[model samples]
Target: MTLLASLTLASCSTILNNLPGVYSIDIQQGNMIDQSMIDQIRPNMNKRQVLYIMGSPMLTDAFHPNRWDYLYSNQPGGEPRMQKKVSLFFDGDRVIGIQGDFKPSALPVIKESEETTVDLPPRDLEKTMWEKITNLFGIDDIDRSTESDRLTEPGPATSEPTINYPDDSMPR
Candidate 1:
């Protein structure tokens, strides 16, 4: 009876550990825009230009053709999730303003429709929503809203492509 009790106790834990619970799938919805893509945004950039740089926005209201929403959300098993929302305001065809987690750089604004990629000078870092709120209350030292924070232009184009892999012919 003593041996039987110990055996049952040992197997109980193993059984519980082996039991499979329903796995929840991580869901991702909306556009996933990165800081580099947001940095490409420039004042006076038309809707077409914005589309070219960052791809299509996830949310576009029928009533608001001038407003574009870039939303991203991710949930991984046993990990903290993240969400980001970027709103671009356009006046007629040109982009007028922007809002969300990132801000543009200080490089000269490039308007070439042909050239899509450009290097930019680094500028001030972006603040979180909490930081912005704290700033509104005059408690935080960081301030993110200013005319100097806007993005400049695309940098000079590179002569060679960034990726050059060596030849690797498969044995036929």
Candidate 2:
């Protein structure tokens, strides 16, 4: 009976410790500093500029007033925790040195975004309720197209075919 009880208790402990279907949320703590933001920091930059680039530091020891520590730890669900640490040493207001997981490159890295600029045609705003009602009854006879007509010099034509959308006023 003692052997049986011991076996049952051991099984219960294992099951309780790691239950299936348990959801453990991703845990993130301290300042989230990325490589891009870290790359922006330069020596001789003042405290305010460092604050702007790296954001507020996580740990500033009272004993070490000149040193600012940026600590970040992320644990996703059941995975192992990953930590990143960056320490900036300051002489009075200006930053003198930096140390940690990331170091400053000889030339500052500038990440150029791959966003393309599209010149979209003007959007046709929906007519107001009153305007719709007036138009439905043929009470409003004012020519809307000509009222706000803007004429611009024709640019070099492109080979792409133009698409004409159906008029909103016309019933489908």
Candidate 3:
């Protein structure tokens, strides 16, 4: 009886929405705007600057060139739905007013306080990869000119290897 019930329930679990071959679809459409984007908007900002701050408007009416609308809607898998709308009113090339579903928060003014220094030694930025490798191998202290010169200087002897082929004198 228990086994029969378990099998029935298992078969029912694969029905409708949770069917085995069904793939859950992600529905995301429109520009995603946030509060930070809204905060960037300032009065009298140029159209180009406003466009750069907020992504391209979702709706632009041909007759109303002065008005631009930004819209966003997202319904991701297993997540709650989200929507944002912002309207920018422009006079000629400049922004006149901004009205939307979001509020622009006051930006925090950073105060420059006393300057502090770490007193650490200046970095040696000129060090090459070979120099770093040599330092890692603990060969930095030694005056390794022969090794260093051999590495940097390119000549015929270093370029190609002489492969030894068996001459006639050897046992065939």
Candidate 4:
């Protein structure tokens, strides 16, 4: 009975040791305002009209009711994903101007450009298969390995450090 218990404990320890690292996910949405929609907002537009056109502002300053900000961001996955932002400014009760990191030229043009027609390299099925096999067998040298190095090393001791503070009983 003791031998069986020891074997079971050892197996459980091995299984726990081999467990993968924790992963996190953040679900993001697309921008609420597109360039075309922003373009429709013209200078000297009424505050109510602007609100009707662009919907509710994303943010408003506590002290300044005249200024309104519309902001949005998204990451579609993979390294170096694209990021976008837009801001509109208002003075008094009218929209005085619109300004942000986004440029009108950078916005998707309606015209058919030659760059859009450029052909991409055809995917090699054999290469993909080899990569999958490598990944499955843990042969890939890339950081994509499921085995986490964190568990292999000893973690810092949980003992809390002592802190000293001056006594508050003394009169000023």
Candidate 5:
């Protein structure tokens, strides 16, 4: 009877070990914005009118109260995610400019469009080969070495700096 019980227990253990691991699927809802709603906005529209048309802004900068940013991002499965960002710049209470992923040319004509053009420097093709080789190997000098011994050899002078903030009232 003891032999039979031991064999049964061992069989149960083996079955349990062979069983597939527990896995859970998590599906997150997409946050892409409706482009039709954005197209309806006019240049002369007030804050209340804009809010009523486009809903609440996603991000608001405290330093620059005039700028209202709306961002919508979504990722489906392992596919590449999509992002839509709209920035409305206000001069006092009136909307001055509107910029985003949507085509500006198709937007309603404004009397005084305050659009600012940005020019980015051209990329160098010489370093492309080196960058591709490094990325393929997935090897980074920073990751391979410890924080303390990155570029410089370990010594008293190379030690981490200690921060000391002096009180304003104390005499030097």
Candidate 6:
């Protein structure tokens, strides 16, 4: 009877997992190559330039030493998987040919987006725990100095001596 009950419970586990309300997470794997990065690649460009533009290739096979493959795939829960790839063949250190799902446009024009920088003021904070506790309890701290006095006071100076170390003159 125990064996039969165990078998019945084991069979329902699969059904429970397949229920309509069950949630599944999306999966993404390998190097993510987009159109803009792909457009930047040109024939006769060096390996260093390609590395800068495309980050790094997903797969590098020892059998084909001169080829670099960039692969990207995404599977959103129950949906079908979507894949993108680009392969570059190198002659010595320079890229010779390109292949795969994406190809560069005839006259590739890179659009630069404008960015704004904002500078924020430095944060003022109480340095010690005792000071925080005293302030919380509505009591005056030990060093009862005004804001102007605190501002005018010099910060803690380092007393440690600095030593000169040997420079790195080793060759690569």
Residue 15, candidate 5: C-alpha displacement in angstroms = 24
**Distance from true location, Cα of 32 in model 2, Å:** 1.2
lDDT scores in order: 0.81, 0.86, 0.80, 0.67, 0.72, 0.86
Count backbone clashes in candidate 1. 8
Residue pairs of candidate 5 with colliding backbone atoms = none
Better of 2 and 5 by lDDT: 2
lDDT of 4 by residue, 25-72 (tens): 444544476766676677788888987877777777888777777766
Stronger candidate by lDDT (3 vs 5): 3
Greater-TM-score candidate between 1 and 2: 2
For model 5, the run of ten residues with the poorest summed lDDT: 22-31
RMSD of each: 30.1, 17.7, 14.7, 37.9, 31.0, 17.7
Q: Tell me the lDDT of model 1 at 65.
A: 84
All candidates in order of TM-score, best leading: 2, 6, 3, 1, 5, 4
- The C-alpha stretches of model 3 lying farther than 4 A from their native spots are 1-15, 18-25, 78-80, 108-172
What is the lDDT, from 0 to 100, of the residue 90 in candidate 2?
100
Steric clash count of candidate 2: 0
What's model 6's overall lDDT?
0.86
Q: Would you list the clashing residue pairs of candidate 1?
A: 105-151, 107-152, 107-153, 108-152, 108-153, 109-152, 109-153, 110-153
